[model samples]
Structure formats: C-alpha cells, structure tokens
Target: MEPKAHHVVIGFFTLVAVAAALVFALWLEKSQTDTEWAYYRINFDHPVGGLAEGNAVLYSGVNVGTVEDLTLAPENPAHVRVLVRVDQNIPIRANTKAGLVLANITGSMSVQFTGGSPDSPVLNGSRENPPVIEAQPSTLTSLLSNSETLLTKADQLLGSANELLSEDNLENIARILENTRAASESLLQSREDLIALLEQFNAAGARTEDAASRVSGAANHAREVLGKLEPVIAGLADSVNSLQPTLERLDRLTADNEKALDTGLQGVGELGPALRELRNTLRTLNSFTRRLEQDTRGTLLGEETMKEYRE
Candidate 1:
C-alpha cells in the first residue's frame, strides 16, 4: 500500500515541533550561564543550615547574583564552600566580606556582600581559581553565642549580688536608712534658715546681674567712642603716610650732609678753646685797666705797670 501524503506532512511537523522544544529548553538553560559573569568562593566555618543553591547573592542588600553551588572545601572538609556567580559589572574587592543572613523572620537565608569602596581595585579571578570572599559568622550563630555569654554574665552578677546582700548587709542597709531619715528630719528643722540663705543668694545674683548690665553698658559706650574716633585716627594715619616721602627726603639730605655737619661741629668745638683764651686775656686787661684807673701813668703803660700794681 502507498504512503499517504498527509501522513508525511504530519511526521515532518512532529519533527519540527520537537526541534523547536529542544531549542527552547537549551536557550532557557543557557540563559542562566550565558552572561558575562565573575565567580567567587565563600568559605564558611559553620554549617550551611538550609542555605542551598539558587539562593540570592546580595551586594549590600541588593540582589546581584545567585549561589551556583555549595560543597565542602577540599583542603578542609570542616569548612563549607559556596560558589557564587555575580554580574561582571558588580565590583568585588579584596575587602569585600560575605555573610549568611536570614532574609526575614521566616524567609530563607541569603549571602550578603559588603565592603565595596569606590577607590578600591576590582578583585580579579577566573573560574579555575576564583577570588574568595571570607564568610563571617552567621547572624544566628553570633546571636546565639552572644546570648549564651550574656546569660553567663547575668548569672555571675546575680550570684555576686546575693553574696553582697547577706544578713549583716541587710542590718547595715537598715541602719543607713535610719540615718537618712534622721538627716531628713534635721533638714526639715532648719528649713526656714535654708530658705533665708537661698533668698540671700538670689539677691546676690540680682546684684551680679546689675553689675553685668553696667559692664555691658560701659563696653557699648567704649565701642561707640572707638567708632567715633575711627575716622580721626584714619585721618592722622593718612597725614603721617603723606608726610613719609618728605621725611625720607630729609633723611637722605641729612645723610648726604652728615660730613659737612660734623666738620662744622668740630670747628665750633675748636672755637670754644679760643673763646676761653680771649676771656682770660680780657680779665687780665680788666685788672690792668683797674690799676690804670687807679694811676693814669699805669694806664698809659702795659704789663709792667700792672705787675708793679700787683707788687
């Protein structure tokens, strides 16, 4: 029997449909790994605790990639290794740290990344040897550990408090209370004196306020006086500045004539001795004149007549 043409067409369509489905399946699988991505490893000392693959890898709270795989470290089986694939554009640096944090009260845990400084260089790695982001203690681990420590400390504190509050201590506490009550009674007895003292202090404070007001007024008056004198002071400064060139010229003239001035002063000093000698001669002549007046013949004469009169 000859094959029907419709059967051939149906068979060809079936093959085409199968091919299309396979291509779509492949595209979907490749979509997850086809992007330009960088790989990083996170080695945690604690167990994964339900943290599994396909979990979100968040960079500072924003989803940047997904956990690709989880396995134990080859070198140390005690450590859990998490392989993550992040967008290549997301800068991973040496300081970048990874930690497992619960998404919310009941949600699954996610890997969080921190420490991406703008100036820090990008961490370089490849699939063969990816850069490692050291895993910090999980939030749950830290909380539980800290709570245990706090409980221990609280127990110690309670024991110490119990020891400090023994029978004798209770009696001492009662005595302290009695002393406080007596002190309170004594304060009440002197209440009026205390009130008078407070009143005096208030009066002193008022006097201080008055003194401060006076000082403020004086300061304001001084500021006003200084403001009024500012223009006068500026004018004086300008006058001095304007006369500077004349002073400088006079200085230069003095420097130039210093030798001549010194010579004139020296001549004046030399004239002093001559003047003294002339005074001596004048005194001698006066004595002679006095003798001459006493005798007209002595006046007509000179030193010989003066000498005779002296004798």
Candidate 2:
C-alpha cells in the first residue's frame, strides 16, 4: 500500500524537521562550548568552606567561568590548590586574585576573581600547568575560621571584667564616685570665686598685652632713631678719620721741634719783664714830647702864651 502524495510529503517534511532539530541541538552544544577558557591555579592556605568543583566563578560580580578542580597541594599539604577555568574574554591579569565567596546565608560558596589592573598583562596557562594566581581570604571565611579564637578571647575578657568588678573593687569604685560627687558639689559652690579668679586672670592678660604693645612701639621708635643717627655717626667717624693725618703731622712736628719749642717757651717767659719795661719807657717819652711842644707854642704866642703857661 503506497502512501498518498500528501502523506508522503508530510513524512518527508517531518524527517527534515527532525534532522534540523538534531543539527540544531548539536550546533547549540558546540556554540555553548565555543567560548575559549583560560586555566589558572590558586593556592589557599585556609579551608575552602562550602567551595566545590563545578562552582561558578565570578569576575567583578559577573559569572565568567567555573571552578574546575580542587586538591591538596602535593608540594605543600597545608595549602589547598584550586584549579579554575575562566573565560578568555575576561582578562585574568597577572595581578588577579581568587577567593571563595558565599552565595547565600546557607553557606553555599563559589570561586570569585577580583583585583585585575588594566595595565597588567593577561595571565596565560594550559591544562597541564596553569599560572598561579594569588588567593585572597574573604571576610566571611576569616570570620568563620577565627570564630573560636574570637570567642575564647571574648570569654577571657568577660572573666577579667568579672574579677575586676568584685565586691571589694566595687566598693572602692563607689567610694571614688562619692568623692568625685563631693568634689563636683564643692566646685559648684565655689563657682563665684572661680569666676572672680577668671576675671582677674583676664585683666592681667590685658595688662600684659598692653605692656607688650608699648614695648613693641618703643622698639620701633628706637629702630627709627638708630636709623636717623646712622648717617650722623658715619659723618663723625669720617671726621675722626680725617683728623688722623693732621694729628700725625702734629705729632711729627712736636717730636722734631722738641728742643726748639722748649727754648722758645723759655725765651718768651724771660721777655715778659722786658716787655713791661719797654711799655713804661714809651709812656715817659710821650709825656716829654707833649711838654716840649707846649713850651715852643708859648714862645711863639708871646705874652698871651706866657700868661697861659704861668697859670
């Protein structure tokens, strides 16, 4: 029994559709895996809590790849070596850091990448041997890991506080507080005296400031006087300098004429009495000349002259 033309057409179309669907599925698989991956190694010295293989890797909060494997480092058993596959598009730089992050409060964690500078070169590696990326400890991981230690310390602190706040210590503290209260009350009562003292201090400060201002003014006046006197002082210095040559000449003359000056002084001293005698003789000569002149006049004047002369 041969199929009808319409049925045959439908069957052929169905086969073609199935084949197309298969091809699409294969292509989708290929396309999904077509993204190039870069492998990197991270060594964590701390426990990777809730971190597992197949966990999503995020780059700056965007899912970029997945964690491939996790194992204990063969060389150092204390370190956990984590192998991650990141998208080649995401620049896993030389300075890239890897750390585990909590996805939710349920404690599910995933590998995350952070701190890749733009200037850094892209980190390269293969499946056989991947480049090592530094592992950063996350805040949550550190808190969780140190929870015990923190609790222990907190317990010790509480114990110490309890011991310090014992009955005797509490009594001492109460006494100190009472004393402080009394001091406060006393200070409150002496408020007026304190205010008076503060006013006195203020007045003293004002007086001191005024004195300082006067001193500064005096200093300025002194500077001005000194400035004005500078030229006068300079002129006096020049005068003294000019007198140096004259003084030197005088000194030389006095030294050269020492004996002559002594003789001249002695002669002048001896001439004093002689000079007095000469003066007296000149006076007498003047008086004689006058008398002689009067006699001559009387002779020439005859009787009237003789009568005046007799009188």
Candidate 3:
C-alpha cells in the first residue's frame, strides 16, 4: 500500500508540471497573435554603421518589429535598401521618415521612425513593390567621420610643424630675424631726417592753407563791392535816361535862341556883347556839372549819405 501511494503522488506532480507548461505556451501564442506585422523598405544614402539583419525597428523609442533583409540597390550601388517588418497597428503613413540611430557608441545600430500623421495614407508595400522610407544621416556616423577628418588634419599639421622646427628651417628664420633687425636699425638711423621732412611738409601745407584763406577773403570782399556797385550803376543809367526829355527841350531852345540871336545881331550890335556873356555863363555851368558827376562817380542817388562822402 505504501509503494502504491508513493507512485500516485509522483504521477500527480508530473501531470501538474505538464499543465503549467501548456498554459504558458498558450499565453505566449495569444500574446504574439495580438501584434500584426507589415512590410516596409528603408533607403539609406549613408552607411548603416554595423546595422545588420535582425536589428530592432523602433517608433518613438518603442520596439515595433525588426529588420527582415538588407541589400545594396542594384541600379545604384552606393544606395542601401533595407526591408523591415513593422507592427501593423502602428500607422506607417506617407509622411513617415526613417533614420539609423546608434543606441550606444559601440556601433549598435537600429532603425528609427518619425513624423507619421493620421491624415496620411498607409505606406503599403510588398515583396515586389517595397515602399521606401527615407533615412537621414546618423549623428554618430557623422561624428565619427568628422573625428577621422580632424585626426587626418591634425596629423598633417604635426608633420608640417616638425618640418618647420628642423635645423635648416630654424636657420632660415634666424636669418630673416637678423635682416628685420638690420632694416629696423637703418630706419632708426634715418628717423630724424624723416621727421624733419614731415615737419617741413606740414609747415608748407599750413602756409598754403593760410594763403588760400586770404585769397578767399579778398574774393568775398570784391564780390561784396560789385554787389554794392550794381545798384549804383543801375541808378546812374536811370538818371541818364531821365535826362532824355530835358536834352530834347534844350536842343529846341538852343535852335530857337540861335536863330533869334542871329536876327537881333544883324539889327543891333550891342546884343552881341550880352549874348557872349550868356554863353560864357552856360559854359561855366556845363563845366561845373561835368566836374561834379566825374568826381562823385554817380554814387549820390539819395541826399542822406551825400554829405558823408561829398564833404
């Protein structure tokens, strides 16, 4: 009885273990079925940087699926094509862009998805017609490349520095320094003469400026005198024009008087003496007027300033 009881306990424990394994398997299958898969292609212009098959595909840091295949494009060997399996529940829209991201500096790479809008249409793809997702340059890859370029430049600079620090180059530099010192000494020796020449030039410039200023002042004064004479000349011309009627009257009077005198002289001899006296007075008056005009220079337009200059 004791042996039969032990066998029954052993058999019960074995059955329980099998039931637990079956339940775990069924749960795993249900979990896998909840996620649906879709296909897509990612085209990269840069190197994938150690990304290989079975690499994770993520959407906003969530693992969605994995890389199904990778290949270099047949038409353009420089381009890389990647086929990825993604969760169908995740909307792979037309506006979605892709990039290769390095999770760590150890070159572990993954595909990153961004910018999928709900209003966008689905990015449907198949084995023959694989929809391409655009990939940007990876930051890590760019950094690595820049670092390599910087190192190369640094190496070149070090080589040049080493060459420049050699014995022959140092001797050449020393010669150049000595020549510069000699030139400086020569310049110092001629410094006094240079200063004197500059001082003389400055003095000449100052004298020239002063002369030009004096000339300018003289020109201004002349211009002012001309301006003042302009009105005087105009008034004198007007005075001469005003004398036209008087001259005409005087000519008529002279013609009449000459005729009358000629007639009277024939009749009376005493009339000749009186006529001569009148002629003498007229000549004296004409002479006095001509002298006055010639002396005053026709400037006495009004009597207000006449006494000031005429006196």
Candidate 4:
C-alpha cells in the first residue's frame, strides 16, 4: 500500500512540472508575438497569388513582422486589404512603399517594405483605422500581365500571316515571279543592243561638251573685240563734240547772208544780156570804116585809069 501511494505522488509531481513548463512556454510565445509591435494595413490592387496569413513582413530586406489577416477591400472587390504587425521601433514613413516578393523556389511570398526618406513624417492612424502602406504590383504579376499581352499579339500576327500566305495570293506571287524571269531573259538576249545604245549616248554627250566649249570661246572672243573698240568709239565721240561749235557757227552765218546771197545771184543773171548787146554795136562801127578807105583810094587815082580799068 505505501509503495502505491509513493507512485501516485511521483506521478502528481511529474504532471505539475509538465503543466508549469507548458504555461511558461505559452507566456513566452505570447510576449514574443505582442510586445513592441505596431499594426498596419496594405491595399493591393493585383491578385496575391500565394500570400497568406503568417507570412513574413520585411523592411528593406530584413524580416520585421508577419501578416495577421487578409480580406477584400470593402469599397472595391478588385482590391485586397492585408493587415500586418511589425516592430514598433521601425520608422514607417509616409513615403514607404510595400510589395510582395517571392520567398523560395516553392513560390512562397512575403510582404516587403522599401523607400522611406529620413525627413518624412511618421505614418499614423487610429486603432480602428491602421495606416495604409502603399502597395505595388508584384514582379510576378507584372511579368504575367506582359506575357498575356504578348501572346495575344502573337496570335493576331499569326492569323494575319495565314491570310497573307493563302493559295490565291501564293498563285499571284508565282505568276509575278514567272513574268520577272521572262523579262530578265529578254534583257539578257538584248545585251548587245543595250551596250550600243549606251555607247551612242556617251558619244552624243562628248559632242555636246565640245560644242559648249567652242561656244564659250566664241563668247570670250566677242567680249575681247568689244573691249578693244571701246577707246576708238570714245575718240570719235570727242571729235564730234569738238566740231559741234564750228557746225553751229556755219549755220548762223548762212542764216545771216541768206538775203544778200539771193541779190548777188540775181545781178549775175542780168549781166549776161548786157554783154551780148555791146558786141553787136562794135561790129557795125568796124564795117563803116572799111567802106570809107576804099572810096578814098579810087578818087586818088586818075579818071582815065579808072575808065580803062572799067573797059
């Protein structure tokens, strides 16, 4: 009987020690979770793929706290609200940004805080309304969104390519290629003619160049001749200018003697008739003198000699 009582006592003490240890552990865990902690809310506009309660909250790559709860935003179903607890000593500023980051290869996620300036005011809120840390789309979310858009565009491109390579279009392309080949063959056959045409064009261009050179030389020669004649033309102009006064004086003299010159011309015409009448009067006087000489000679000779002469 005494041995059984001793065993009961030992069992009781052992049970008490285990209960005390359990209570101490519970208190330690509670103290660790609740002491010097602050609460905050983060609103994410994109879907949080693998984030859940009890995930770590990191501040600039250091683990500071853990997420407590998650719910859809009351005002908009598209947004999600996440409640978190962090160390109260952390200087969560107004400009601090929050985002979800990948934790491991299993795609586990955690909330991360970044970008707080020293001078920014502390983020503050009441117990009922915790300060909201601005949330950004996770890298995975952005990559997925971009991939979806790229796939859609690729599908459209493929559809267009299919239409472009249809049977009718391919047939048209073949016909164009056949026509181009025929044209190329025709050009190859006419190579000599094309070369001859090119040669003729080159000859014509050379002749045109020679003609242009000759014309330029002729123009220069004409300019030189005109330049040489400039002085001769100037001398002639000077001579004409020097004779201008003489020509004017001759004009004035002719004007002044116009009446006297007319009277002298009239007198010369009247002198012609006076000279003819004087000649006729001199002829009559000479005839009378010759008759008187003949009579005198006959009287001086004897009357008998004159009679004999008459017989």
Q: Top model by lDDT, which number?
A: 2
Question: Judged by TM-score relative to the true structure, which candidate is superior, 2 or 4?
Answer: 2
Please give the distance, in angstroms, between residue 163's alpha carbon in candidate 2 and its true position after superposition.
Answer: 3.2
All candidates in order of lDDT, best leading:
2, 4, 1, 3
Write candidate 2's Cα lDDT for 1-311 as tens digits: 35688898999999999999999999977975998888988889999979889888898789988889999988888789989898887788888888888887888788888887899998888888899976989898899999999999999999999999999999999999999999999999999999999999999999999999999999999999999999999999999999999999999999999999999999999999999999999999888678668786654555344344553
1-311 per-residue lDDT for model 4 (tens digits): 99999999999999999999999999989988677777899999987877899999999889998999999988998899999988888878999999998878887889999988999998765447799876988667787658889899999999999999999999999999999999999999999999999999999999999999999999999999999999999999999999999999999998999998899999999988887887777777676556546665544553322444554
Q: How well does candidate 3 score on lDDT at residue 233?
A: 99
Question: How many clashes in each structure?
Answer: 0, 0, 0, 0
Query: Candidate 3's residue-wise lDDT over 1-311, tens digit each?
Result: 99999999999999999999999999988986886778898888777767889989999888998888999999988889999988878888999888878866677899989888889998876666778778877677677658888899999999999999999999999999999999999989999999999999999999999999999999999999999999999999999999999999999998879978788879797778899999999999898688667665543443333455655
Candidate 1's C-alpha runs over 4 A off are: 1-44, 47-137, 144-151, 277-311
> Which of 1 and 4 is the better model by TM-score?
1
The best candidate by TM-score is 2
| Better candidate number, 2 or 3, judged by TM-score | 2
Question: After superposition, which runs of candidate 4 have C-alpha atoms over 4 Å from their true positions?
Answer: 1-35, 60-62, 102-108, 124-129, 138-153, 177-311
Clashing pairs for predicted structure model 1, backbone only: none
The regions of model 3 sitting more than 4 angstroms off are 1-30, 126-129, 144-150, 164-311
Clashing pairs in 4: none
Rank list by TM-score: 2, 1, 3, 4
Query: Distance from true position, residue 70, model 3, in Å?
Result: 0.9
Distance (Å) between predicted and true CA of 145, model 2? 3.9
lDDT: worst 10-residue window of model 4: 302-311
